[model samples]
Each structure stands twice: as structure tokens, then as C-alpha cells.
Target: MTRHYLRNASIDQPLNVLVATPAGGTGQGGIDRIMAALKAELERRPNGVIARFAPTRGKGALALSLFHLTHFCARIAAWRLQRRLDLVHINLSSRGSTYRKIVIAACARMMRVPYVIHLHGSEFRSFWSNSSPIVDRSIHALFEKASRIIVLGTPWQAFIAERVPNAHGRIVIVPNAVEEPRVAHVGGGASVHILFLGRISDRKGVPHLVKALARMKDVPGWRATLAGDGAVDDLKSEITALGLADRVTVPGWLGPEETARLLATGDILTLPSHAENLPMSIIEAMASGLGVVATPVGAVEDIVKDGKTGLLVPPGDDSALADALSRLVQDGELRQRLGAAAQAFQRRHLSIGPYADRICAVWQDAAAAHRGEASLPALVTPTDLKA
Candidate 1:
């Protein structure tokens, strides 16, 4: 099928682009929400950086891989006919994400389309280092070939610069944007509600949180809600064993509305994760006017100033975590103070509109660079449009 193009037409239209990522689900994780928000924003913007979404992963591993391959092949098939695509925006993380995207990057290269890789996973550094030698080399090669590699925070940017030195010049920092609240949250009960949102797993420091709550058992008038799924049985068992079952409730996963309600109830939002890359829970907590008690891992310190916007403790230090939580639990005035600061910070800096605008700029820049490398004609599109 020979699709028509705007050949020699007015240079008003920006280059066509496609975003390839794992999508299509009801609030699966951070990446899904981010992509959905960006897609909505891109559509709203009038001129420059039009986009198409190609979902790569779905359910099962085998099915997901096959779907991704077919999607890439379809794009290549279209390229043969129209050459309409100017950039291949690839969203990635680590492990299988890197593996699949490396292949997709190859396909994009074969199609002569420039590609950009957006890193999302919290444990990406470990993923890169722990992978087999062959996989590591392939990962580096993919990073090197990308026109731009966007990471969530300065921590990741530094990680890539030191770890993937070949991608030093091309790495960019764009933090994750979240639109959510805590669900399964009941409030107005005159109890300090400390909320922990995210996966209930070892990596997320669920055990450490249970221990912290156990430490706070003697502290008066405070309850904790642990939301999200992953190792729920172990988390519940740990809570029971530590005699925190009365004060702590583990609500496996929550919908957006429930999450929002729960976030609204929070006096303090806490996540003592051992590793992270700007976790969406903290951003949402900040947005919801809740004081945050988190470890200074990933970009937690980037947005959260100690004792200003939020409180930070060392990861895996249950005692420090307890002490931090205890401080917030005891001082209602301080909680309100920090929560106000957090909300202000989020509204001013971490809102989705600004995030989308920044991403729009990145897409535009990547497309422009592709034009430069290919010596293609420049698009005379007007700037100043907010994405």
C-alpha cells in the first residue's frame, strides 16, 4: 500500500513520530500512567510532534514478546511504503525491557528512523549489572545507538554516565509524573494515618516498614495503610508476627479514586524502599499535601529537602525509619507544615502539565536531530505551544 506524503508541501507539519512501549491496561504501573498522560497532552497541543502509540507488552511473557515483534515489523512495513515516521520513541527499563527494546531499536535503525529510550524502572542499574555479559553488551549498544536516553532523575543520569559511558552526552533527566491518590483509605478518625503506597515487596522495603510500624506500636493515635500488591502473604504474615496487625492494614491494590482518598487521609506518606527512581507514590503524596518519610535513594532527595518539603531517612534502617515516622506521628503541627511545603513543591515543579511540556520538547528535539543527521528539510512549525 503506497501511502501518500506531504512531499514538497509546506513545512508546517512536524515530523511524524511513534511511541513504542508496554501499554493498554487499567493502572498497571507508573509507565502506563505517564504514557497515557503524555499521549493526552500531545493530542491537545496543536502543532508539532504528533504521535502514535504501539503497545509492545501485554500479558504473558511469550505473548508479549510476540506482540512486540509484530508491532515492530508492522512499523517497518509502513516505513517501506510511506517513510512517514521521523522518530521511534521507545520507553524502557531493565532486564527484559532492555532486551526487547534493543531488538526494537535495531528494527528502528533498519527503518532508518531515529529512536529515543526513556528509562523508567527503579532497579535499572542492578538490571544492567546483573545481566549476562552478552545482554550487558547489547544493552550498552542500544544506549549508544539511541539519539537520546531519558532517565527519571539525576541519580539515574549519573548512573548511566558512569555505567553506560558511551551514552554520556545523550543522557537526559525527566522525572516521572503521577496523577493518583491513595484508595482504601478511611479518615477523619483522629488518628495519624501514615500511608505506604507501592509494591509490597522486599525491594520496596515492606519488611522494613513493618518493623518500623512495630517500633511505633507504643506511639499513640496513629494507624498505617500499606497499599499495592507483591508479596502480600509475606507482608501480612510479617505484620501479624510483629503484632502490628491491629494498627496496620494491608490493602493489596487500590483503584485511582480509593488511592486518592487514602492519600487525602495521610498525615504522612512513607516508603522506605531500598532502591528507587523517583517513585510515583512520593510524587502523588507530595501532590496530595502529605508529609513524606522516605529514604534518600534515587531522586527522593532531588525533590524532597530534609525537614523542608519532606523527611528522608537511610534505606533499610528500620530504626531510622521508625524515628522519622515517630517524629511525624507525634507532631501534628509539623506534619501539616511539611505537608503544605510538599504540596507547594509538587504544584510548582512536579505537575503533569509541565512534565508533558518538557517531554514534548524532548520529542521535538529528537525529531529535529534526526532531520539534521539525515539532512532532511526543516519543518517551519511555530514554537511556544504548550504540550
Candidate 2:
């Protein structure tokens, strides 16, 4: 029952794409990775394609008001440009303001330009819960109307398929790919250096990770590093409350090189999020050759193969998380085996080249379809897209 998009040779030409993303860039999460990958693909074009990086402002708005305004401006700018632009690729979070999605999608339709909707994280679930019956119907209408729907993993594909069966054929899964770091085989010891990198938010389960580590205080020679910025005071207070001031290290946010260096010193990377969809941090950790310990959320199960590449526990179970960490901390052979396996997985399947190629095919197919040409067979599958 898996459908694919067939690329039409006639319409398969270099595209001028408008990539819309949140302002801060790739450091945010998977959306950032998608933007980065799309840019990389656009660079490979011989005639050179126009890929404008449009940033949305305002973080706490209900519907991302600033993003919608920015998107509108980008649309106007794209229209004014005399060059031929084939598609508007939108990296949309389900949690983004309804106004933003509606405005952007409507603009694409008005312009008669094919638009690709890239769904990230829990936005789908959020939208499903937030909308009224009428609004929900309209939202599903939008999902069905998109030229193509890009999802992160199998779970999301299923979510969309269950709601919009016909549109399942139009859905394409393209998981985030991590760049392999040059430094390899870094960090592992009795100290069992563990790094938790990401925004310091409740959703990220930072406090949960801290609580888990607090319980393990009796386990000597173990230290946890909290890198990245978010609710600084809250995280610091939690660290103090847990009496893990000494056991836990919060170095705040680090630049790419510095983050890589910090990751290079870790034996294990842990992220016990309540919800997630193919976290870039886990992929980066795997690329860094660190044993990963994460919850079974999003495409995490697809990457951390429980006792194989890494370990996965129930999302909110601190004890299970701690147990998993303890196993890797005590067993060097197991850690090496998992780390090596993870590295191999990344090398074999998660390379950026194949990922970019698949996305390029999606964009080309959408563009071709908009031009009244036959669609391309789906170049990727739900399973293929999983991290």
C-alpha cells in the first residue's frame, strides 16, 4: 500500500525554490536540518537554482504571526523577481500559528505555484488537538490540498494516512540527516561522561534527565553535562534541588565547533523527551560515535535500535533511563558495540547525499505536477525516511 511519486522527465528541471524556516537557523531542530539539506541540494544545480532562506520572527506567538508576515513578504519578493521559481518549500511546525500555515498555503495556491509542506515534530498532533470540528475539517482539507506532504518518520506518515487516506499517496517521508563529525571514537570512561544537548524546556525532558541523574548520585565516577541554552534559572534551580551541582555540568549553549568538542568528550548522549520526531542531537551523537540513550518517541525507535545501536526506554521513566545509562556506564564492551553499530548505521543509511537527492526528487515531482505533467514515482518510503 506504499505509494511513490514518479518524477516526470519533461518537467524535471532545475528549480527556483523558496525555503521558509524559523529565524535562528539549523540549531533549532529537525526543521533546521531540512533547511540546511535543501540548501545543500540547491547548491548542486548546474544552472544554479534560487533558494531564498526566509526567516520567521517571534517565538512565543500562538500562530507565528511574524513568520506569516515574513512568508507574505517572501511571496511578494519571489513574484517580483523576474526569474522562474518553480516551488515554495515550507518547513512548517504543526505548532506554528494557524494564520501562518493558512496564509502561506493560500498564497501558494493564489500564485499557482506548487508548494511542499514539510511537517516537523508534534505539530500534527498539536493541530489535531487544537482545532474545532469545523476548523479540523478545514485543516485536513489543507493537508489533502498540498502538492506534497513531507513527514519525518513512519509514525507521522501513519498519523496522516489515518486521517487523510487518499492523501497518503501524496505523503513523502524524509527524515533529518546528520553531518558526520570528523572526530570519532571520542569520550568513554568510569566517569561515564554524558551530554544532554538541546533547548532547556519541559518538553525536552531536561528536568526528567536531571531527576534521573540525581537518583544515580550513589553511583560514583559518573558526571552529566548539560549543554545548550533554555530557561537558565529553571535548569540551574533544578540542578541545585537535585543536589547534583557537582555531578551535573551546565555549560550553556556552545557554538558548532565548541558543541562538537563538548560532544567529543562524552561517553553517552541522553535525551529523554516526552515527545520528539527524529532529533538532530541524537543523530549528531551517533555521528560523534557516542552511545545514545533516548526515549521511544518519534523516529527515535527507528535510529536507536534498543540494545543494538543504542538503548530506548519509555518516555517519562527516569528509572528506566537511569538503568539504561548504568548498563552502558558499567559495560565498556557494550558501549563500544552500540557506538560502533550506531556509527555504521549512519554511514550506511543516514548520509546527507541520499537524503538531499530524495528531497530534490520530491521538489522536482511537485513542480512537474503543478505544470500539468505526470508525477514522479516516490523516490523514498516511510521506512527509508526514518533516521
Candidate 3:
């Protein structure tokens, strides 16, 4: 299905692009933001670059087996399509298979197309270290061969530089961007409505939030909304077990409009994720003028100024999470001040336009480098074609 889209995309002259991801057309969260920013640039500039989305097919009953198989197949299919693409961009995650990485990197080299790899986490310490030594070495080799690498934070930039010294110059920091809030300012009140809006997985620290809510339920009118789906039964059971059913609402799997509406109603946003690589939800909340309470992870520190734009707590520390939430829930003045600062910060730095421009620049640089090496026939620019 996606291959046909790529073939049709090739017919256009600007620059035919392919976005290989596990996410199909749904475009939720960070993936959605990326696709939207890229599409906007392609539409406005008519860069002939049409991004085609492809989802990897998983196999096996076990979660690990399914993950491995899906990554392997996705890479193989992407490797085959490298010949047709002028440049290939890979979104690297912690869960990818080593075999798939080798195959995909080899294909990029064989096709002689410049490939850009985007790093989204501190996956090296969390997942890769636990895997076999051979797998670790293979993953290192994959990072070394990339034409360019994209990172969201200084920590990742330093991590990649220290570990993969040779590839230091190729690393580009392009933080995730968020769309500006659309609705009227729907914040500032006594009864603070907090939200945790993402996958309810262990890594996300959903259980931690539940426990914190259980402790703080005695605070008058303190409520929370968990607006996503993942381990739904487990989360629900935990909430029930903790006696937080009245305080924390699990309204599962909200669509964009619903999600945005819920966010607008929220007085504050909190995400106590164990790990992250610049969560878009936090940025969206900031854009919506809501104070944030999150664990210091990924590019969060870059946006959130502790006690100013938002409050930061240590990851997995349920006590600190509860403390931060309680502080905001009790002080209306503090919440409004943080919310305003967050809104201003997001408007100044995290808007989608700048993100679009940066990504387009990266793509153009990669495309230009590929063209220079290949010495392909000069093609007309979009403006030239129009003329």
C-alpha cells in the first residue's frame, strides 16, 4: 500500500520523501506533530517531497517477539525502497532489532543515498545495555554510518558525542514542536483539574500518578483525567485498588478534538513518565496555558524552568509528584503564574513554524548532499517549474 504511494510520489519533481515508521495514518502524539510540520512545509514550498507513512507488521504472541519481527520487516521493506528514494530518514527507538539496523544501514550505503537517523530517547542505557554484546556493537555501528543524526536535547547530544565521537559533527538538535492552542483561555480557577495524557504504560509512570492521587484525594476538588489507552485494564484495576476512582477519571483513547478540549479544561498538566524524549503533550499543554508538573526527562528541562514555567519532580518519586501537584492545587496564584510563563515560553520557542523550517533545512541539506555526490541531472526547483 505504501510502496504505491512512494511510486506515485516519485512522479512529482520537487523531492519524493518517505517516512518509515511503525505508525500508519493515525499520526498521534509526536509522530503526528512531525508529519504535520513536514506536510505543511511540503505544501507551502511545493518541494515535490511527499512523505509516505508506513506501519510495520508485527509477528508472534509475545510482546518482545512481535516488536522484533515488526522492526525487522519494516527495515527490510525500507531498505528495498532506498533505491527509489533520494534520501531515507529513520526514526530510531530503543526497541529496534539489531539485525534490522544492520540491513537498513547496509542498504543506505549500497544505494548511496544520504540517510538521516533521528534519536528519540536515552535508549542506550535502558534497553541496549541489557541486550547481548553483539547487538550493542551492531547498534553502535548503525549510528556511526548515518549521514546525519537528529537529537532533541543536550543530554542525548553529549551521550552520542561521548559514545560515537566520529559522528559528532553530524548530530543536529531539532527539538519537538507543538501547535498553538486554538480555544479561549480556559484556565485559572479554584478546583484545579490536572491531566496525564499519553500511553498508560510502565515507562509512562501511570501507576505512580494513581498512587499520588490516592494520597492527595483529601484535598478539596482536586481531580485528574487520564486521557489515553494502554494497559487499560491494569490501570483501571490499580485505580480501583487505590480507591482513586472518584478523583482520577480514566477517559480512554480520546480523539484530537476531545483531547484538546480536555486539555483546555485542565488547570494543570502532569506526566511522571519514567523515561521520555521530549513529549509533545507537555508542550501542547504549555501552549494551552496550563502549568506542567513532570519528571525531569528528555528535552523537558529545556522548556520547563523549575518554579517558573512549570514544576519538575524526580522520575519515579511518587512523593515529589504528589508534593508538586499539591502545591499547585492549593495555590491559585502560583498555578496562574506558571501557566502564563509556560504559554509565553511555548509561543516564543516551541511553535510549529520554526520546527517546520528546521526540518526542511535538514532535508534540503541531505538532499543537496546526495545530489552533489550522485551528480544527477539538474532538476527544476518548484519556483522554476512555476515560472
Candidate 4:
């Protein structure tokens, strides 16, 4: 397929976009980061897209989160009355996220506003495949009503087309993007630094990562940091048991600034997860010009082309993971090449400027479709990002 870009000129009037998500600027999830970055980027640009964030979930209990959702619904009614709502862009995952967005979409439909669905859940396939028939119908209904459905990558676009055939024409692939690194990347001092950014759990393959590092204990001049929340103690214990306590640092979770500092000095970004949906960490790392070593899961293959941008190891295979890491650790030339290519890939396909352009184009299309006007030309899709 030929790569195409959206050529629509900037809107004459400000486009009011109500963004609904779990936690717009406060949450630690990938969806939150993407929304936060998009919001910040849009604010800096005069693109005429006035994005108003409406966080549906919070860090509090379920009832508290639901209360927030209730408030969001009320705001929809209020905004509609004021004639301020032009479109809604919902950032959604599976489970509770889907349920909450269902209500938000219903409210949008009731208020006669066009809304778009952006799927961000990595485990959505399992969540949908194991759901009851009634639940399946509800999900299908949600997508059926969406004016446009956005996915992180081609695989997810295919999933939506297969599951919700009627919505196939509306599906768009706009992978998550990250802002450029604020601090210049100075290669890891002395030793090769391997950084892992994400939750610390079996699902992220933390245990397997620990074992892999243990196998590479004999490989000199290398250290690792497994950063994020969840099962921190278990991971620390396993690292100690493997006698990799000296080389691996388990720093529960990092704030944005801390993570940025690490990225500035890190040489390689690693995430050996068993499941994912285009992790923001990889994008962030690539933006920092770091070589990546990750497992091929979720939409990871969409970005991390093995031997080109980064080295890929089979998930849960500690031996292969160790070998890949060792090769990168010993080959400075290969590390430089991969890191350079990964950074170039990020600039070409995942930079924030083009990402915001694509999203705004989608919002324009959705609103136009809702108003019974001809839709704008298609926006940039995954195929368009290919070199």
C-alpha cells in the first residue's frame, strides 16, 4: 500500500474535542501517558483543536471511579446544552474501561454528538474471547455506534474488522506516540545500561528477565533497572535468589522526570513482556535513541523489527533473552546502529507532531460523518508509516 498523509487544511474554527479516558493526566497507565502527551502537544500548537479532558476513572475505589464517570456523563449533558461539544474521543481498554466508555458513548449518542473509540488494551482479545454472549453483543454495539474506531496497530485494526465487521470501514490504525526526549541521550557511562520500563509482574516477564540477567552475570560491564509498580518485593526476592542483586535495580515506579533522566543516560531499553499493545516505553526509548531488546508480543512487532531497530527474543525464553542481551552488550557497533535506526524510526513514524495531526484529522472526519457531510480524506495509517 502507498503511504498517504492527511492533506486537509487546518480548521477555520476551533474544534472542540471532549477527550474521555481513565485518567487524563494523573494515571500511570499507557493510555494516560498518551492522552497527557497529546494534550500537552496540542496545547503548544495552534491546530484549532481545543481538547477538553474528562477523566472517567480515578485512583480511588471503584465507587469513586464510577462517581467520576457519573460526573463525566453530567458534563456531557451540560456541554451539549451549552452547544460546546462537537466531538468525543474516547480512550478505552478492556473490562472496566469498556464498560465505562459504553456509558460515555451512550451519552454521546443521546446528546447527538459524534464520538471516536481508541482501543488501548493489550489483553482485549482474551477479555472479549472469554466474555459471555450478552457481553459480546454489548461490545459490538459500542463499536457499531462509534463514528470512527482507532486502534494502536494493524493487528488491532484486523481484530476489530474480524469481530465487528460492520465497523470495518471506520477502523483506523494510529499507534501510540511519545514526545521527543527533553534531555540529550549520553550513552550509559562505563557499563552498558539495560532499562526496563513497565509494571513489575509475571505478565511483564520480570521473573524471566531476572533469570536472563543471571545467565549474563558472567558478561562484564552491564547493569539493569526494572522500573514500575506491582509485585516489587517478589521481583527483588527473585533477583536476590538469582544472585543478580548487585547488577539489577528494582525501583518500584518512576515519575516522568526520573524516567526521562534514566532514558537520557540509558543505552538500551528492554521490555520482555508476555503481552502488550504497543507499549509507550518502547516508543519513549526509541525517541531517546536507545537500542531496544524486547519480546515479540502485542503490537511490538509493528515497531521493533528484529535486527533492524532492536533485537527480539521469544517471550518467556530466558536463554534466548540472555543471548540477545549478551550480543548487544558486547557489540558496541551493533548497539549504535540499532539505536540510531530506532530513533530514526520513531521520528518517521511515531513523533508527536504527526501523531497529533493524524488524531485531529480523525476527529474532523468523525464530526463530519455525524453531520451528514462527506468525510475528509483518510488519515495516516500504519501502512503510511512504512519506509
RMSD of each: 5.7, 3.8, 7.3, 2.5
Backbone clash total for model 3 is 3
- Report, for every candidate in turn, its global Cα lDDT versus the true structure: 0.76, 0.73, 0.70, 0.86
Quick one: best TM-score, which candidate? 4
Model 4 scores a TM of 0.95
Superposition TM-score, candidate 3 onto the true structure: 0.81
Model 4 residue 6 lDDT score: 32
Instruction: Residues 8-107, candidate 1: write the lDDT tens digits.
Output: 1224666677887676323457777678767766576554556777677764565567776676658755963586777888888876667778888888
* Residues 237-265 of candidate 2: C-alpha lDDT, one tens digit per residue: 88988798988888887766677788788
Residue-level lDDT of model 3, residues 1-387, one tens digit each, is 112112224234545455544453245556554655555545664434555544432322435545644564455456546654566666666655345445556666775666777776444456766868887787788888876778887777777888789988777777777666656657535568989899988788887888788879777867888878788788888888888887778888887778778888899899898788888889889889898999888767877889889999999898899999999998889988999998888777777766655555566556765555331122211111000
Per-residue CA lDDT of model 4 for 299-360, tens digit only, reads 89999999999999999999999999999999999999999999999999998888888888
> What is the RMSD of candidate 2?
3.8
Error of 3 at 14 (Å): 2.9
Off by over 4 Å in 4: 1-12, 380-383
Leading candidate by lDDT: 4
Regions more than 4 Å wrong, model 2: 1-13, 24-30, 44-49, 58-83, 182-185, 188-190, 383-387
Query: Comparing candidate 2 with candidate 3, which one achieves the higher TM-score?
Result: 2
Which candidate order results from sorting by lDDT in descending order? 4, 1, 2, 3
Q: Which residue pairs in model 4 clash with each other?
A: 228-252
Residue 143 of candidate 2: its Cα lDDT? 80
